[model samples]
Target: MNSTLLLKKLYKRNLQPVLTDLKFAIALLLIIALFSITGTVIEQGETLDFYEANYPLHPALFGFLSYKVILAIGLNHVYSTWWFLSILVLFGTSLIACTFSRQLPMLKVARRWSHYTRAKSFEKLPLSTALEGRSLDQLAPVLAQKGYRLFQTDDKLYARKGLVGRIGPIIVHASMILILLGAIGGALTGFVAQEMIPSGQTFAITNITEAGIWARPWLPKDWLVRVNRFWIDYTPGGTIDQFYSDLSVLDKDGNEVDRKTIHVNEPLRYKGVTLYQANWDVAAIRFQVNQSPIIQLPMTKLQDVNNKAKAWGTWLPTKPDLSAGVTLITPDLQGTFLIYGTDGQLMDTIRVGGSSEINGVTVKLKDVIGSTGLQIKADPGVPIVYAGFGLLMLGVVMSYVSYSQIWALQVGDRLYVGGKTNRAQVGFEAELLEIIDRMAGSTPSLSAV
Candidate 1:
């Protein structure tokens, strides 16, 4: 019995105070905001080589943040870091503590009606007045008409309205806790993968760029994604307007289960996995050189010079000795190619199925194969987060309602009336005056003192 009492005292005095302290909660929120900003400003889930080149030691970012520092502190993966997750957990605990220790008790107090027996008790109220020759029977109907729930005795009466206002803070706390739980769940069970698949190629989910420790179960295993075709839309100015990929979801038997043509801002979702079109590239070039069998050569993206646009290039040998060849370059998938001879001169420009004479051999361009880049992700907590936001909005609306209460007592023909409200003081005063006028107008013997 003594040990249980000691534990209760410790909980009430030490653990409860620290967990429910508003200042501590605010500090944790500020820390979380700061870390979120840091995560956004510094790229997350980048390779060590990327950080080494971008955040070098000789010219360190902000004079202190080097690749070594980033790696040591786990800044590259801020949301999943142990310390960050601990902060989230602590903040969530604080919200729970606040809800139980403060909001629930306040709600209980609001639910109970207080009966004032003496006239002196009403004197301390924010709005108080005494009515002469008034009875509880006359005031009950007035309070009822004003949308108040009444609790009455023989001489004392209490009335209250808008009790839901007191519950708003509790709902807000619960919503915030739910949002934190969803965030933590996503951080623990989500994964992001990137794929660059050529047209007509089928592949499974691999090459995960970022993932939580327990994200393997969320990854798709029974299905594969196949890129049927990839094409681009160009504007009149010869710039890319949009790109699309016709993708199909295939089961283990290679039977198509779902298909969609996805572009930027349009994604394909299947079985909790979302695929977004992120990038595109030229994969290979198909051509024929005079009586030679059709050949397909892989194209390489060339380095941009002087802020020039992106282009892909490939070389095709025309002679048996491989001494003479021609370079083919294209800036887009518009079926146009620029042919350059071995003498470093522009030989001609040709479209698909068009021929050009280079090194005394007729070259015909057949097709330019394009590859689609897809960013795939699986997050299991989005619905919970959305629900939390909806509840938060509802709580905010409910909190605006005014929770008002009034008390009355009769002592020898003298009636004491007093009321107070948590919000809208002016409106509450007007409402009280209106109720008094109604009581005076209804009962000819009642008059305000």
Candidate 2:
């Protein structure tokens, strides 16, 4: 008995703090949600270099106020934040507590039949009514035809229906709980990997945020993904028409397990993982160079050993002609270059890593590469979220649709009838008095009925 009392005291002590924490969590969740909406109205994930180039005059301020920092702070990835997740947990707990502590008990009480005085009290309600009847038994069957359960005691009658009425709020609250759970499951159990896989290439996800692995103890280990082909089609008017990818999932031994064609709206799912059409970008071109042997200079005894040795660096057209030779006058220094002749004479100057030409020699670049970016994800909480949606819809529909009833109390020859509804109390009251007039075969007054 003492332990039970102690437990109750402990629960009471924790209740206020838990409620306060829940309030804070709700406020923070609202702030985050508002920030997400505002961020959508703005832009996100722009580079410092882009901002500096675009707003050159106010580079410092522009860079400082840009969304890049927010992205770094994981606002672009807000649904995956630690605090956001914590809020989900707290919200779920509070929802559970509120449902169990308040809603459940009220629902239990609503499930049972109540006194006819309850119906009589509703006559003063805004949506209540009164009727003159010689016998309630005659009207009870009429109300039953209209889908109400009639209860009679002595001279008072009570009628009610839609016992599931109380489930509406419960279902609504359950949906919220399920939504939070689904979000948490998506954040934790779900894996998000982005890859710019070129057409006709297969690759494995080897990197994640904070150098995490693709396969955790709770996830699949041998899941492999491959992009067999990618296509981009344009409309006759030169607008984007369609974007798609031919993809496959592979087994541990490199055997194909599944294959499908995925488009912007359509995605490929294997096991629990899904590949989405996130975006696309251009890949780097391949560049190669042939080096010519040069004599190495030895450091002198008196030379400073800490200093880096400098050399001349240059490039020339790979041709059999003596028309041009690019010279690196000081490769070890800043990007300084000098064009030269076979006779070892200077022709023109250019910066290293910068494009330049000399004499009749011509340079060529080739092998432009491109790729499509895909967002790979796996989530286990989607069913819960969808279930929650179903429940919320049912709750909302039921909450708006309600049941109404009217009752009459007869003692000897005097008849007194009252009306009530689960909703629209004021309108129901006026309609009830109007109905009372029709039953009495005379107009009604507040003092004379």
Candidate 3:
């Protein structure tokens, strides 16, 4: 019994106060906000080489942040770091403690109906009046008509409404707790991957760019994604307007399960994984040399060009000994290719299915195949987070309702009336005055003081 008493005392005096302190909760919130900002400012899940090039040590970023610091502190992935998750858990516990120790008790007190039995009790209320020659019988119906719930004894009465307002803070706290749980859940189980798949090619989730510690189970292993076709829409000025990829989901038996044409901001969701059309590239060039078999050569992006326009190019040998060749260059998948001779001079221009005799050979451009860049992600907690936000908005709206209460005491010839509201004080005052006026009409001798 002595040990139990000591434990209770320690909980009440030590652990409970710190967790219930508003300042501590606010401090935790500020710390979380600061770390969230840091996460946004710093790119997450980049390669070591990328960080080395961008945040070099010779002139470190901000004179302190370098690749070494980012790796050591896990700033490369802030949300999954142990310290950040610990802070989230601590903040959630603080909210739970505050709800139990402060908000719930306040709600309980508000729910319990009590009457101001003495005239002195009326003196402390924000809105109070004493009426002479008025009984409780004359005032009860007036308050009831004004939408005030009433409780009465022979000499004391209490009436209240908008009890739901008292529950709003509790719902708000609950929603915040749900949001924290969702964040933690996502941090531990979500995964992100990227793939650049050429048209007519099928691929699986093999290149994971970023993932949580326990994200392997969430990764898709039973299905494959096939890119049926990739095409782009160009504006009148030759700029890309939009790109699209027709995709199909295949089962292990190579049967199509689902199909969709996805574009930027329009993602395909299957099971829990979402595939977004993030980028595109020129994959390969298909052509024929002098009625030979159709040959497909891989294309690569060119660098160090004078013009900054993006272009992909490949070389095609026209002679058997590789003594003569031409470079095929195209800025986009517009089926137009610029042919350059061995001396780097523009020889001719060709389109898809068009041929040109160059360097003693007939070169035919069959097609230009494009690749679709897809960003895949699986996050199990997104629905929970959305639900939490919805509840938070509802709670905020509910909290605006006014919870007003009124009390009156009848002592033979006098009635003491007092009331208070958690919100909308002016409206509550007007409502109370209207009730008084109605009671005065029934008792002509009644006068408010």
Taking the tens digit of each residue's C-alpha lDDT, what string does model 2 give over 342-398?
Answer: 677877665534444445433322222335678766667788889889888988887
lDDT for 81 in candidate 1 is 88
Candidate 1 residues 178-277, lDDT tens each?
8888888888899989999989899999999989888889999899999999999999998889999999999999999999999999999999899999
Ordering by TM-score: 1, 3, 2
Model 3, residue 323: distance off in Å is 4.8
Candidate 3 or 2, higher TM-score: 3
Worst 10 residues of 1 by lDDT: 440-449
**TM-score of candidate 2 on Cα atoms, chains taken together:** 0.67
After superposing candidate 2 on the true structure, give the runs of residues whose Cα lies further than 4 Å from its correct spot.
Answer: 1-7, 10-29, 38-73, 117-133, 210-220, 234-241, 281-370, 403-407, 430-449
RMSD of each: 2.8, 10.3, 2.7
**Over the stretch 105-224, how does candidate 3's per-residue lDDT look in tens digits?**
999999898777678878788888878888889889988887888999999999999888988988999999999989999989999899999999999999999888889899988999
> How many residue pairs clash in each candidate at the backbone level?
0, 9, 0
Note the Cα lDDT for every prediction shown: 0.89, 0.60, 0.90
**In model 2, what lDDT does residue 58 have?**
46
